[model samples]
Target: MAEALQPGDPAAIGPFRLTARLGAGGMGQVFLGESASGRRVAVKQVRPEIARDPGFRKRFRREVDLAMKAGGFWTAPVVAADPDAESPWVASQYVPGPALDEHIAAQGPMDEAAVRRLGAGLAEALDSFHRIGLVHRDLKPSNILLLDDGPRVIDFGISKAMEDGGGSALTSTGMVVGTPGFMSPEQALGAAVGPASDIFSLASVLVFAATGEPPFGHGASHALLFRVVHAPPRLDGVPPGLVTTLDKCLSKASEGRPSAHEVGAMLTETAAPAAGRPAAEVDAGGIPFDVRAPSPAPESAPTAPNPRAAGAPAQGTYIAPARRVPPPPPAVAPRIPVTPSAVHEFAVQDGGPAVFRRRIRKSALWTALITAVLCTSTALIGQLLAGVFLSVIAILVGFLPRLVGALPLLVRSSLRIDARVLQMRLGGTAFTVTWQDVALVSVSRTGNTLRLVVVLHSDAKRPVPAPLRRPGADDDREAEFLLISWNDQAVTSRAARLHATLAAAAGPAYRPPVRG
Candidate 1:
């Protein structure tokens, strides 16, 4: 969906220079951009008026945070953002692929196996978002990119953050934020949208992918919304393998829908033996998440075999059965019960309460042991020097308080998120920051290590000491505002868990940590 940049587009926003227009949405224009160093990105700049609104800027900030968490192999990850700019803009990794709508229009509907792969990938993307307490209220073909590998979910433009009850938190008064035909029943009714609404939309997308048509058939906005809320989805052309899952997802009652994790599992189980599945003769088919199949060479000679050949059937040509026999259960036949799957059933965080602890310094104990051993050796070797042994004992004993204090058991570097405040204990000192002062918690990459940082709102009355603070402050004075400092050794490995726990704890204030 790349188009030439229009005349009015800015040459650059922050460090990114605009190259081409990606697309436009209700929030703003998205452009293809490149940094001075040649890193490509999709930079979305908010409309001037929208950026001027305080509430919209606040929600834009939330969008940056949610988009950050909407990461996996299945979705574009956020790279950098400036939500406070005059015309706030955010950038994400650029994905080179045609949007799903364009792909369908150029080619045709995806066959069964291809649709299964797309469904699985989309489901996993939703799983990642849902796990982090985020929802893509606007799941549609346009927001999905069909690549040779799989589909990529883009655009968090109007995605709303879910609160304690899993309800939308950023919807404007009298404004519904979703594509009409793809939105859920509750969304159409202006109800509190949640993860289930996304599931409904996901199914609608799958139906579109399978049939080259919207599930309810598209038309006027109000009419589409009404059909979505009142009528059952038109799954007439959906592959048998996907029909039942789509039906469940398109349920009128959101509670009756399957979780993203479950949907992914079901698709994998329901698809035919992947080995026997034919490669897409079409451009949009043949992707298997992990790899892409080669496109078959076109035949120029008249002697080439064809499914519609007058004498013989072609490679992918379907031949009808002579009898009006009962078709073996459609790919989506309910008879194929979905049993539990270890690989498919993944654990996702749903804003549940969790205690996040700062990493313990494992080397502290070994360092203390080595120091004690070295001291004992020095004391023994210099026994004849009279005061040497006593001096060594005094030196080692004198350092006991410092050594013991650094022990993991004694050192207090941890933060607890309460309903009203964030309680932090660092360097044996305790302090509390009200929820209003804290803006977000993110895990960022710096060199080889990744660490967590707590960002405070700019308007906070008592700002925490930052790296930009005045130089020359003593250790004690510095430790007072140590809201975001640590060398979390295990942070790189436990990133997903840490991200979910911190995101849930931080709520709307959470930001996606930077990734390389």
Candidate 2:
């Protein structure tokens, strides 16, 4: 920064007299200046070294033009610009507020409402630039002022007009132009960007306001670029409503994101949820909230099904209950390997409209059963010599079938998706459900461990649904539900696919809940 000066310091330029040095950046110094009309302004002058370069002056001229025209409620109004002078300068109305980065460092992160206000205001500001075919290539938290009314985005020195073609010579190597933590994937790659690129940056800014850090956060520029290109945004404590919208904006592919206008509408519509008292009330006109598709019944299997047929209306008729099978018992002992193709195949497909089950290789069940029998018989024969051996064999054989069935069940539960009907196949029987007939899935904490409970929807006319116990839960239902414990990323993706299938048949768009 230049030396702080007092009144009448004789650093006057044109009608404005420089009062004090406010701050300095790589390109220029910002001075506190007062115009002849008694208006305060922050004047920035091009560095002397860069001033001699003709190319730099042209770029500086473009920045001046962008600042002059880019007027909005969420931006400090431009006061004056002189590109033809000895040292080019631009002055904007002096705003008395801390930079967003400084505000967060001084007083933690703003709460949800403040973050929302910041997002909406910034969205409106970006919309103004986007509407006129301009891109503010730099939009880091430091460039935003946290005012009492809302945020005001400043520093359009790198803003590029579509008519001006692309970035200036400063980014000649296809190098990124914006701050690393806030740059979109396209911007990081030095690719031509449209309005979505700014939307991505805007999302990064919101993340910073909500969490006191950008999604990519503090790191070397190259590392940050890698995260921007391939990693998910790290939003550990952000509100759920904003998370999905932020995720959309920070998509790796530019086309996957919504425009600035869509972001503004989302912020506006999200406010309506607060008007209602219920916490988890279904939003009537908000974004779609479909989860998983309803499972198809066995009798509805299509005959001569068309491979490319449109989804058929899901026949939702409930099936009459026979005997409900218990979950397979826990694994007790290891057994002999069985030959392939030893067990009969059963059609048990689920969650489809027409085709419910399909024939799959039956080798796995055979292998499990054969191993169980061998382990059981070995201990049983030895028990004749010693009665104590009998206890061991009984324990081993009793739980064999249950163990065989449970391995697949555990795999399916780890999927992080809400299913309409959860299905589990035990030996000789299958358990299917209509969503309304299902109760809550419980997560409980006991000591240092966590447990899960699948509480069935108790019905008046039907047999009680089996209580599926989590392995470590011991039938408790209060443990923290780890979304990844049962259904991992792969299973969640599968659930999404199922939901899409059912939604197609139902004639409504579907959007899943925000993943925790």
Q: Against the true structure, whose TM-score is highest?
A: 1
Tens digit of per-residue lDDT, candidate 2, span 383-476:
3334445444544665445455334433333222222433434433344443345445433333322332344444512333333333454333
User: Which candidate's lDDT is highest?
Assistant: 1
lDDT of 1 by residue, 425-474 (tens): 55445556765677665565554334445556667666554432324533
- lDDT measured at residue 403 in model 2 versus the true structure, 0 to 100: 51
Query: All candidates' TM-scores?
Result: 0.54, 0.50
- TM-score for candidate 1: 0.54
Q: Give the range where candidate 2 is weakest over 10 consecutive residues by summed lDDT.
A: 317-326
Which residue ranges in model 2 land beyond 4 Å of their true spot? 1-10, 49-53, 173-175, 272-516
Output the lDDT of residue 501, model 2: 28
Off by over 4 Å in 1: 164-170, 274-516
lDDT of each: 0.65, 0.58
lDDT of 1 at 68: 87
